[model samples]
Target: MLEIENLHVTVDGKEILKGLSLKLNVGEVHAIMGPNGSGKSTLSYALAGRDGYEVTQGTMRFDGEDLRAMAPEARAAMGVFLAFQYPVEIPGVVTMNFLRTALNAQARARGEKEIDAAQFLKAARAAAKTLNISEEMLRRALNVGFSGGEKKRLEALQMAILKPRLAILDETDSGLDIDALKLVADGVNALRSPERAMLVITHYQRLLDYIVPDHVHILADGRIVKSGGAGLARELEAKGYDAVIRSAA
Candidate 1:
């Protein structure tokens, strides 16, 4: 469970999240739909404790702990995962190696026993298969020279393997065809459970068709202006962002 109150964040000295407040409870899937510059990604980064995205005001409480007090790795170990809109390419680090290291690191941070090589191999392969990631792909460099769909699937695979408590998916459906999108969405949907929560930040409603959210919120000017059930997502899809903002105004 994550609670944010009047969160104000600034990136490179320019404010992005302005008086934004959102609370994600266990077992709830919240979708944030907004046009560009509405601070959706900022909220994700602020929650992930990314460097340079400073919280100027407000408090973020994760699992009852002050989120700002913990390092980024600490947040991940606390079951927070952020799937970037544009996954960075890390050359030289094989996909399997990167995942193994990340998983082991998080486990060690949380006082859990490190997974042995055989266990990691079995788990990674299973998770990757759910995302349609082949063994060949996992042997390649991490997100290097991969297509957009490949990158997104890889992100989903990471989430599946991590089994995060709160997953923040920042435009995971971006740059994908209908088929590819379905694959990625299915991977995301598989991770949904009563003990987990997800914040799906998407610009379009098509993604919602596959990964249905329990609540949909319209974020504008760095704050959530409206909240509704699944019907709201279809309304925005039919009317567009400008219409929604005008109506909210």
Candidate 2:
């Protein structure tokens, strides 16, 4: 569903992603395992068309459409979702309201009818329950004063409600305890569908143990150095990033 070719990205005039290429098909979950500065997050931001992460060279296409030409909101309306590594706190916006607004905005942008309050409430409550989010949490301002686990769970809840065609999870496992990680991973795994694809960017194989990506890639030096099946993640776990990249080299 997504194809990138020799993508070179520059952030603030410094090149971070150099000649990177990847392809993800529908119904596949791909895991990108890389050390710090490997351009994992850069890939996600570039795919999502985040401002300031300029694509200096190469092309990114989603479902045969030129992704670079679309704005972030347009991309969201086109079913691209990026779950941030650090979810920001939005004070004074109730979590439920924020989800409803975002969902309806995407619907409107896609020329679909808006979801009424009762329908949205039912969907949100069901998703929140699956993610173990409490009713009180939904009533509170989005991510305000929440713990790391709470913030991550909220991100998962957003993903569940958004139901993007392509989900790019940028280090969603960071700062999450084992229990919290399991909850978040379960929520992610539940959304896996034949019509959906997920790009899971993470530092550790622990997340992969739960998500179980169809393909595992080792990204290093702003490029993907090695790509393999799920076993590659376990190998990386045993040998470490330096050793794995060295072996790939």
Candidate 3:
């Protein structure tokens, strides 16, 4: 569903991603594991079209269209969702209102009729219940006064509501407890289907235990150093990234 070819990204005139390339197919889950400063987050920001992360070279195609040519909102309308590592709090923006607006925005872009208030509420409530989130939480401002786990849950809630074709999770497991991690994984697993793809970026293998990936890729110094099956994650945990980096060198 997504193809990134020779991607090189730069921020503040400093290149971070050095010719990174990877391909993801619908219904597949790929996990990217790397140490700090290995350009994992940079790849996610680049793919999501975040500002200031300049694409020095290479191309990205999503569902047969050039992603680089599209705006961030345009990409979202075309079914790309990014669950951030840290969700920001938006004061005065009610959670339900923000979610409804976002949902309708995509629906409108797709030429589909917008969901009515009643229908949207029903779906949102159902999704929130699945994620163990209370309706009261949904009524509050987005992420305002929420704990780390709460913020992550809210992100999952958004993903569940939107159901984007390709979900790029940038360290969703970071700062999450075991229960919260399970909740996040369950939310992701619930969205898995033959028409959706997921790229999970994480530093540790713990998260992989919950949302097992079909493929595990070890990223180092801005490039994928190794690609293997799920077992690779366990091996990396056991042997550490130094071994992988040494092998790549």
- Provide the lDDT at 40 for model 3: 95
TM-scores for all candidates? 0.98, 0.98, 0.98
Off by over 4 Å in 2: none
Q: What is each predicted model's overall lDDT from 0 to 1? A: 0.94, 0.95, 0.94
Q: At residue 76, give the lDDT of candidate 1.
A: 96
Per-model clash counts, in order, read: 0, 0, 0
Question: Candidate 1, residues 197-225: lDDT per residue as tens digits?
Answer: 99999999999999999999999999999
Task: Give candidate 1 misplaced runs (Cα > 4 Å).
Answer: none
- The best-first sequence of candidates by lDDT reads 2, 1, 3
Query: Candidate 3 local accuracy as lDDT?
Result: 0.94
| Model 1: residue 242 alpha-carbon error in angstroms | 1.7
